[model samples]
Target chain A: MVLSERDNHLIAEIQDGLPLSSRPYREIGRRLGLSELQVIERISALQDGGVIKRMGIVVRHHELGYTANAMVVWDVPDDQVDSVGEKLGSQPCVTLCYQRPRKLPEWPYNLFCMIHGRERERVLEHIDSIVASQGLEQLPRKILFSGKRFKQRGAKYR
Target chain B: MDDTDRAIINRLQESFPITDRPYLQAARELGIEEDELIRRLQSMLESKLLSRFGPMYHAERLGGGLSLCAMRVPQHEFERVNEQVNVFPEVAHNYARDHEFNMWFVLATETPERIGSVIREIEQLTGCRVYNMPKEEEFFVGLKLEV
Candidate 1:
């Protein structure tokens, strides 16, 4: 979508995250010389255009008692990937799931899902359940848990 | 997935108040009663659409070890390798980014050494090389989906 100067500015401002205030949009509008309604309308338009994804909280799972988190990758057959991925992604425990290209002789997993829990064993149990249910007994998979947390943030589409 | 859900998501994306009664404050800001806000939030949590609604801490300030790692698994062994790698508690979001180094995952650990050890264990289990690419410089990619 064509982003006007004002729209670009608005996107940049909110990209840093909205201020923690009673009237955040108003505050932002004041800075941009636009009314709160105007700001909201612009954001809604951007969202409708698919320029902005979802506006939601970005929590620290570890701090919130989900001490254990892991990324699980699956090698499902090409034809069944969509059905399998949809089921896997819909799970409550699965946080992030998407399809990415596999590099031959290097990377091979086509489907990826992230599962988090309070304990390591709990996370594994969930993964095992998913693998078995999906009838992926023949497909190979791997789980890479975090050894450290360096940085994490929502995307900035300025 | 509808208009109401989109509106609620937009509201949640913005930070909630930091006051003693944050929920009450949020309710006032949203022009809704405290109880209503609480009810909606509970419902949102019940729905997987809202992954979480809470604090986004600065891990570096707290001295946490974080890095992005990738593995090269042969097509035949991807599922097995995925299971072994995910067993670790420290793994966070894993993406199948389109790259030669496929299978990208994030590790948030308490120490840097632990990051190495975890990679080592994955390498042994998957029988593949683990590329530990820790970020030398941080790039902030603010990706918010307009639900």
Candidate 2:
């Protein structure tokens, strides 16, 4: 969606996160030369239009004791990818799931899902349960546990 | 984190009201004082338990692009390549994973076409081939980590 100049400014203002104040939107509007009502209305409209996927506290899983998160990659057949992906995505444990391209002989896994848990054992158990219930035991897969998070932050447009 | 903190995290992760006094409204719902709610949030931020608290914009819908790119950097050259690749503001999140493709990072650009240009620049700067893996499709998953 093409955003207006003012809307772009609004996004830039809140990119870091909303202000911690009684009148957070009012503070934002003051910076953008807009009224509190206008700021709130614009944000509400953007959210209602699905431009804002979510608006709330973004947790750092590791800090909250969810240290183990593995990127589980699956090599599902071409025709069966969508079904498998949908089924995998439906699981509550799979925080993020996507169908990315395989990089030939070096990388042959196309389907990817990220499962997070406080413990490695529980995370693996969850994966095992999913595979058994979904009848995906035959699929070849690899689990790459994340290490050394160099950087993590919300996207910046400005 | 205490019980109160956990409750706040779980509740706030689902939604945060946008209002003249959002904190007050949320505090009432969570059965806590507004000042206490704000205080806990502030402490959490300082302690790094809460990475951020705000809107998550859909960059694609806003004409931006996002891709997960990986490079198999030799162990000796990993540090140099990491600093070089991270200089670009477009590289949002970078991680070292256990795999043949050892380095994985997310690129979020202001424009969709910028994704390719950034990838080209990274490859040139690091002298490593980047496996550009842009998502062809994303399955809908509303549920997130409860904690």
The prediction achieving the highest lDDT against the true structure is 2
lDDT, candidate 1, B1-147, per-residue tens: 445445655576665543334557667767777776666655655664455554343334324577667776676786677777777777765655333455767777766677889888778777899877564332222323323
Clashing pairs in 2: A1-B61
Q: Which residue runs of candidate 2 sit more than 4 Å off their true CA positions?
A: none
Interface RMSD of each: 11.4, 1.5
Top model number, DockQ: 2
Candidate 1 regions with alpha-carbon error over 4 angstroms: B1-147
What TM-score does chain A reach in every model? 0.90, 0.95
* Candidate 2 lDDT score relative to the true structure: 0.90
Docking class of 2: medium
Error of model 2, residue A41, in angstroms: 1.2
- Taken over the whole model, the C-alpha lDDT of each candidate is 0.64, 0.90
